[model samples]
Target: MKHPNDHYYLITFQYLGFRYHGWQRQPHVKTVQGMVEKTVNYVLKDKPFKVLGAGRTDAMVSVNNSAFQLILREEVSIDKFFKALNENLPPDIKALEISKLSDSDSFNIIQDVAEKEYLYYFTYGEKMHPFCAPFMTYVREELDIEKMSEAATHFEGKHDFQRFCESSDSQDDFVRSITTCVLAENTELKANFFPKKSYVLRVVGKGFLRYQIRYMM
Candidate 1:
């Protein structure tokens, strides 16, 4: 049941997760959610509201597109709120859009997600610029790109990923189908400080276990 004065809205945004610990709010720590909440409270003059992220990102993991649900004790103009929110949010974080949500929308972020894609970027043989640390992992050891590329296919299809995941028993199931798993030359993300040659491990599936992607890399 909806509360008398409560309203729900969906906010889409992106953030560079390097500075913050992660997306979740924690006491006495800088976090993406904490920054967002602080800004919201500031803009709304300390109005009561709660923010719920669609998913949590690990430290230093950037996101291009993500969403959060905002529950407010009172209604507010989305246009004005969005404008104010963007103005107050940190430079690394940006609000892309805002939309009102209703009971009939049939959207449950956790359950309705059809699939998720993860890209792990890395450059081998040399240390990358400090700026690239947030966007990609640097590997000092030399790697056989062709061999790694072929091995990536082994992770495709369904198999027991117990060892690759953390706390396998925490979940009801261990088998996961990686619809797309491959290693290819890095082309998706570009930066002036990035290495001339880099590769990315692309993985896509219905769901992922905690730290599964990192372990796979």
Candidate 2:
């Protein structure tokens, strides 16, 4: 239940997940949420607050855009808070925007999401430059791109994805719908150190179970 004094805000941020364990806060481990809350606490000067992420990402998985909900006991100067939040956050993480949420607003970050898109960048045959390790995956053997592309289409539409997900005993439903799944030549990201030829597996869905994308790839 929300306290009468509680002030709710929705914050959008992005992070390079290469260094953090994941999004959730865990004991004695660095995570995106851990760092974010730490910085928030610092900026708020020990003011009571709570944060909840829209969703969690796996270790070493980077995000171009993501968000979280922040609940505070006291209101803040939005411009000053936004500026300070970005300045204090680590270089790999950035605060994009912050907006106040009214009490009557019907927004639940976790449940209201329309869809999520994931891009798996990769290259094969030749080893990638060391600099590319953080952003791209490397496969030692040459891959049959055509075959992979064709196979990606099979995952489109609603289907039981139990084989592709890591589920727990408490969870029985494994069905998921894929609005888009395609493999294509990489044109989205370009770096001078990146390989001359590369590819990306783009997957879009309402939700994904843990390790589903990794297993699918």
Give TM-scores for every candidate, taking all chains together and pairing residue i with residue i: 0.91, 0.97
Weakest lDDT window of 10 consecutive positions for candidate 1? 103-112
Task: Specify the poorest-scoring 10-residue window by lDDT in model 2.
Answer: 102-111
What lDDT is obtained when candidate 1 is compared to the true structure? 0.87
Error of 1 at 209 (Å): 1.6
Give the alpha carbon lDDT tens digit for every residue of 86-182 in model 1: 9999999999999988762467766766777888999988789998888888888889999999999999999888888776455777788899999
> Against the true structure, whose lDDT is highest?
2
Give candidate 1 regions above 4 Å deviation.
Answer: 1-5, 168-172
